[model samples]
Target: MSTTSLTDRLGSLLMAPVHLLMRIIDIPLRAVQKAAGIGGMAAVFLAPNMLIFGIFVLLPLVINFVYSMTGGTAFFISERNFVGAEQYQRLFTCTNYLDPMSCQEDAFWTAVGNTFWFVVLQVTLMIGVSLITALILNRDLAARSFWRAVFFFPVLLSPVVVGLIWKWILQRQGLLNFGLYQFGIEPYTWLTDRNWTFIATIGVSIWAHMGLYTLILLAGLQAIPKDLYEAAEMDGTKPERVFRRITLPLLAPNLLVVVVLALIKAVQIFDEVYVLTGGGPGTSTLYLTQYIYETGFASTLRNPGLAAAASILMGLVLVVLTLIQLGVGQRSEKKGKR
Candidate 1:
């Protein structure tokens, strides 16, 4: 045979078993399609994903809610007694709502306070810094790609590694203090003071996660039409005015996404802060997630039911944030259509 004919024969030989397997599969699938139609086939294809979601997500959520309502330190669901909303009641039972010391679950309230401040400060700073970084990176600069990579490198690191790196820099006798010592200044413990520790947590968190937000806002910035800026420039429009009229309006959707995501992430902050501070300077850096984790798994007096209740409360906050995001998104979509 000629070379072309020999190649054709080899290709046909390779495809033969694949074609045979498809033919065998199609026989049963044709019968299924005739009986159930296209929609049924879609459901059949989706069944595996749905089963995985139910097992991993829905099942645990139901179990957590159930555990929240029950009392006792029992690991087994059957062994625990259902005390109704007793765990919630204990959490809410405070002589003064503002004072954690007056509450039955004082550590929980302290965490709530710390988390509230952390969320407010961290989210605000995170959004501001990310926006500034994004704006700067969007401009034409030397080694632009390298600068972008440098800014985003922290995001590629594990949260624990971020914590450890910052810890080494901020701890007593660490890099920061050693620098101060070299400058003929007394070494100071950055992680020991309560105020500084809390601030460090916020700073470290912003550093670790800011790269992702910067990338997000940078994408948004890039997506804005250069034509708009050009038009504004031709008309002698001020930079501030151009940004206000064109850039901000165009970037609103991406800004909305960044805000909601950052808000949720700030609420759930744990690993990095945990590794950095261990909820000390005496619970100053403690947050809701860590509170739940310690209560559920790490505490000497482990209380899963109480932990579940706290988690459910936290989940409710997240649900509200999600609903607000959905509402805003829908409203924006409606406005766009209008």
Candidate 2:
């Protein structure tokens, strides 16, 4: 061999030990995998993702539960005194359970009251308006795609942005007020007053979120067999009768989904309301989430234990609500089957 070629060949040989070490390691892995079979392979592949979920999701939930059972301003679990259910009891303590003024944590009860109204109003209007929008869009309307995008655009905007945009327009001396002034109507306190603020938040919420739920209902509307509508048309069924007899029955599942999801969102609602009103004029818009946040993070008395307890209670209420809804849905399905 030529000297240069021989030198190059010797340099390539230096990698042999590294390659051999990898091969040695891979041999046992391959053997174990082959012996363990397909289930083992799946387990191996899934281990990383499962570990991530355990660390991020499960671990935080466990820690929150632990926090709820403890007392003190201490950050560490071991350092905090184990108070059992005292935190929960603190929340439930009241002279008159029905009256928020009688509660130890009056703010929490007030939040609960306000939230109940918000949920009732918001979910009602949301479903009603979204269903109407979906019905309109599902038809051969002019500029259909444009209108759909116009509605869906709000859903894509950040909650903060949605709040800020509405707040600006509705604020004193803002767009609405200016328009009203032009029409010779005196400017009104849109965001400052409790009643008006509640109305504003509910309206903005419906406008912002209706699109996503509209799309959901639209999908459900489309999924109804076109042939069914054609059959109804041929039979000379009135529009309202066709809708009641056919469309609504078929769309009930999506409506349920929309209602349940809207309920949950209304329960956990904070960001938009917080940005818009800061729970304001005087905690009128304060939601359970805001109450929980103030309890844990915002106040000088940062009681994580109490906040955790409140969150846990909120979670329980949601769970119960969901279970009841699911049970009803399942019962209806079984009835339909029969």
Candidate 3:
């Protein structure tokens, strides 16, 4: 058989089912369009996507809320006893709201407090570092591509891998301590000490994720109009003044995106912190997600209802935070437009 003939046969075989599937789908779409015009045609195209969203995202959300209302060890929703807001009451029952130790669900409250502080520090540091790096990388520099890749490499690694690698490096006799010892600095406990452990986790989280936000900001920087900069240059504007008057205003939208995304990511932090700290040194680093998992799956009581309730509370916090961030962003954008 000739090569051209074989290639032609292969193409027909590959395209045969594709053409058949399109025909099969097109017939129903055309019939719907003929019967109901634009609305039906739109529905036909949208049905699959809506079905997917409902099955995957909406279904789980409904199920989670259902589970949050129930009590007992039953895996099936129907079998579980509906406890109303008992779990929420348990969560909120506290002598002093400011002091986590006074709460009925002390562990849960501890996790909540820790997570609040973590978000504050992590988001602040992450944005600062990402902004600085993005600024540097946006300018013409030596091996800029190589440097960007180096920074982003950690973001590509699995959360588990990054956690383990950092754990090894931060251990008592780990590579970090080894380096310190070489400089006549005594070994310090990075993971065991309460204060140091938190600082370590926060630092690692910032380091692991900053590159992604940097890329976002860097893209935002690139999209700014060059003519604005050229005009600034012609006016003999100072670098700082140009940045403040032009770059900052234009970059507000992307900066907003980065802030919102980074905030969400910081709030939901679990995998890396879990693998790295295991909520260790007496649950000092236990974030809300880990606390939920440990409550539902790993605790002696196995309270799925409580876990679900905690998760719901966490979701509410995140939603509120997102709304505030978005409101601020919208106002900033409006001001920029003006």
Candidate 4:
């Protein structure tokens, strides 16, 4: 046989099994399509994913809500007694909301306070710093790729590793203290002082996670059409005016996403802070996630029900944030159409 004939023969042999398999699959699919119609076929295709989501997401959410309504520390549902809304009541039983010490669940309230402040400060700084970094990276800088990699490198490190590295540097006997000693300054306990420890958590968290946000904003910055900037330059528009009018308006959608995501992540801050501070120095760095973890599993007087209740409350905050994001997005869309 000629070369073309040999190739065609091999191709036929290779595709024979694949064609047979397709034919086998097509029979049932066609039968189902005939039985169900187009919309039903779409639902049939989506059924597996919906089933998986129900099993993993919805089921766990239902179970968690159920657990929040029950009393006792027992891990199993059957061993626990239902005490609906009591755990939430305990959390709310405070002489003053501002004063965590007056709360029945003092630690929970303290965690809430810390989390609220942390979210406010951390999200603000995260957005600001990430925006700055992204803008700089988007410019025609020397070794631009290298600088991008440098900024994003920290994001690749595991949160545990981030905690350990910062811990070693911030510890009294660590490199930071050693450096301070070299400068003839007295070594200070950065991770122990309540104010300093809280500050350190914020700083460390920003350092650890800011890279991802920077990358996000950088992508947004790059996506803006260069033609707009060129046109503005030709019109002798000031750089600030150009940025404010063209860049900011275009980047608003990405900025909105970054803001909401950073807000959620800041509220859920845990792993690195936990490993670094252990919510210590009199619970100064204590956050909601750590409080839940400790309450559910780590505390000597473990209260899974309380933890579940707290988690549900936390989930409600997240839901509110999500709703705000949706509302803002719809408003933006309406403005865009106008």
What are the RMSDs of all candidates, in order?
A: 2.2, 6.8, 3.3, 2.3
In terms of lDDT, model 3 sits at 0.90
Comparing 1 and 4 on TM-score, the stronger one: 1
Error of 3 at 64 (Å): 1.3
lDDT by residue for model 3 over 1-338, one digit each (tens)?
69999999999999999999999988987777899888677777788999999999889888888888899977788889999998899999999998989999999989988998999998998888998999999889999999999888889988899899999999998999999999999999889999888988899898899889999999999988789899999999999999899988888888888888888998899999999999888988999999999988888788999999999988998898799787978887788789
Off by over 4 Å in 4: 1-17, 34-37, 331-338
lDDT tens per residue, model 4, 44-104: 9999999999999999999999999999989999999999999999989999887999999
Better of 1 and 2 by TM-score: 1
Q: What is the lDDT of residue 133 in candidate 2?
A: 95
User: On residues 124-192, what C-alpha lDDT tens digit does candidate 2 reach at each position?
Assistant: 999999999999999999999999999999999999998899989999978999999999999998889
Give me the candidate number with maximum TM-score: 1
TM-scores for all predictions: 0.93, 0.87, 0.88, 0.91
Model 2, CA-based lDDT: 0.91
**By TM-score: ranked, best first:** 1, 4, 3, 2
lDDT of 3 at 70: 91
Expressed as tens digits, the lDDT of each residue in 1-338 for candidate 1 is: 69999999999999999999999999998998888898899988788999999999999999999999998888899999999999999999999997999999999999999999999999999999999999999999899999899989999999999999999999997999999999999999889899999999999989988889999999999988888889999999999998888888888877887899899999999999999999999988999999999999898899999999999999999999998889878977886698
Q: Candidates 3 and 4: which is better by TM-score? A: 4
Clashing pairs in 3: none
Better of 2 and 4 by TM-score: 4
lDDT of every model, 2 decimals: 0.93, 0.91, 0.90, 0.93
Clashing pairs in 2: none
Ranking of models by lDDT: 1, 4, 2, 3
